[model samples]
Target: MAAKTYSAQHFVECDQCEENPAQYFCKNCPGQLCKECKTEHKNRKITKNHEITELNTKNEAFFGPLFCTDHKTKQIQCFCVHCKIPLCTECIIESHNGHAIQKLTKAYKEIQDDLQKKKEKIEEDLLPKYAMLLKTENLKQSDFSKQAQEIEKEIKAHTRQLVRIVKQVGKNATEDFQAKLHKGLQRIVDSEVEIQRKIEKLKQTKDLLSAKIETKPTVSSFEPVNERLLDEFEKLPVLPKYHFSKFQPGKIESMIEKNFGKLPILKIDTAKPNEGDSDIDSQEEEVEEEESDSEVPYNLRLVQESRRF
Candidate 1:
């Protein structure tokens, strides 16, 4: 082989002699080696398989570290799996003795493959799937809010209708009660007027009897007035008793409450897609129809009591 050339500025001294300019760089010894030193390095049993690159083939600045830190004259050729560190031949025999070790190239290839697999999984599967899941959850949240609002509106409308009905019922019941009360009161007033007339007649007859006695009028006239007074007194009218019927408002409230209780469990039929239909548009249409079909009817009856005053 032709003698290797060395650049003046890029020249490295041989690690063994520290005299001649280095011609070969040993990746295992990780040090510069002159021609003489290279011969000696190859002869050594531990460094026989060490990779050596010609320094003259490329720029010296691009070359990586050729010598081990702990073993100054040795190169990092092996990796210690246990400690996860690079080692020279001497390091392997000394500190990393009996540990699981492999060539740096072999460890590099294996670790590179593992990292590539992880990157592919993240880019192709994990990240996309997670993003889709996030989108679905957001849509579900929006749907939930929308459905809740719609149900609330329906509830308010139903409640207003119920309130109107209750109010009308109450007004009608009040008017009916008032009419009955008025009729009862008028009958009582008429009885009172008749009693008053009889009292006045009795008073007049008594006064005539007194006048006859004082004047010493004829006995026949006084006797007749006394008899008429006794008859009017005996025939006095008795007053009739009256009372208002009890109106229970709580029964109406209870009926409303019972109907309202069913609101939570009221079944709204949802449209289901046929098993044979696989079209996405069909599925969406079915969902929309089901949503539109969902209806909760307020089934309530007015509670009223019947009583006579």
Candidate 2:
């Protein structure tokens, strides 16, 4: 082989001489070796049995056995099937005797494949659902503001016909309407925040899995993949339902205050069906007077509780 040049800033030094760039790695010693040192390393009686390999980080790390955490001097040789943990020679004899065991390399490859599947699931399934939910929440926010403005217009138009005393009542009603509007919008806001948080969490998990899968598989990664990742993502966030009260203009009867109608009472009908009808449903609020014969309460149903593409 021809001589290879070395960069002063970025090169691993030979473990034996510490003066020349290394060209090989010994898995037995787990150390770097130069061309001259590699020749001498293979000649010695005791050290001659050491296994030397080309100085490639990925190949060396993957092929070499990992040291046991419990028994520092012993290399991990197998995986305990029942415990779902890597085991060294000492571990097999002392702690995991007679336990089912499998080759470490095989277990490492299986884990790598499992992690790849998890990363793909996040990318292909969970992310799109959250993106759609985010879009729907934004549209609902805009629609709520528009509907509230329309109801305010109805109140203002009716307020013009009442006297000073009735106008005061109208003012109070408008203030109350504003307060309710704030509360409804806040519900939508809270849902949006929750969906956004879930989306970010899924993205981070996807990135982590991708990174771990791309890099060389380690002993930690060889352990069983957490089942919760798939279980938790199977459930998407549930959008909240909102109740909006429509403004009803009271009747201005004779000049006597007693004859003038009282402010409209807002009632919500929980029995109304709002789901399983469509992908996106927009229902308007029904406004009615408290004394009126009609018992139908106001219904402000918007968007399905859950949706599918």
**What C-alpha RMSD separates each model from the true structure?**
48.7, 11.0
The lDDT of model 2 is: 0.67
Query: lDDT of model 1 at residue 302?
Result: 26
TM-score quality measure for candidate 2? 0.66
Off by over 4 Å in 1: 1-63, 66-74, 81-84, 98-100, 164-254, 263-309
Give TM per candidate.
0.36, 0.66
Highest lDDT among the candidates is held by which one?
Answer: 2
Instruction: Give the Cα RMSD of candidate 2.
Output: 11.0
For 75-135, candidate 1 gives per-residue lDDT tens digits of 6766778876667889888889999997665554454444444445445644454344344
Give the whole-model CA lDDT for all candidates, comma-separated.
Answer: 0.48, 0.67
Relative to the unseen true structure, what is the C-alpha lDDT of residue 108 in candidate 1, on a scale of 0 to 100? 46
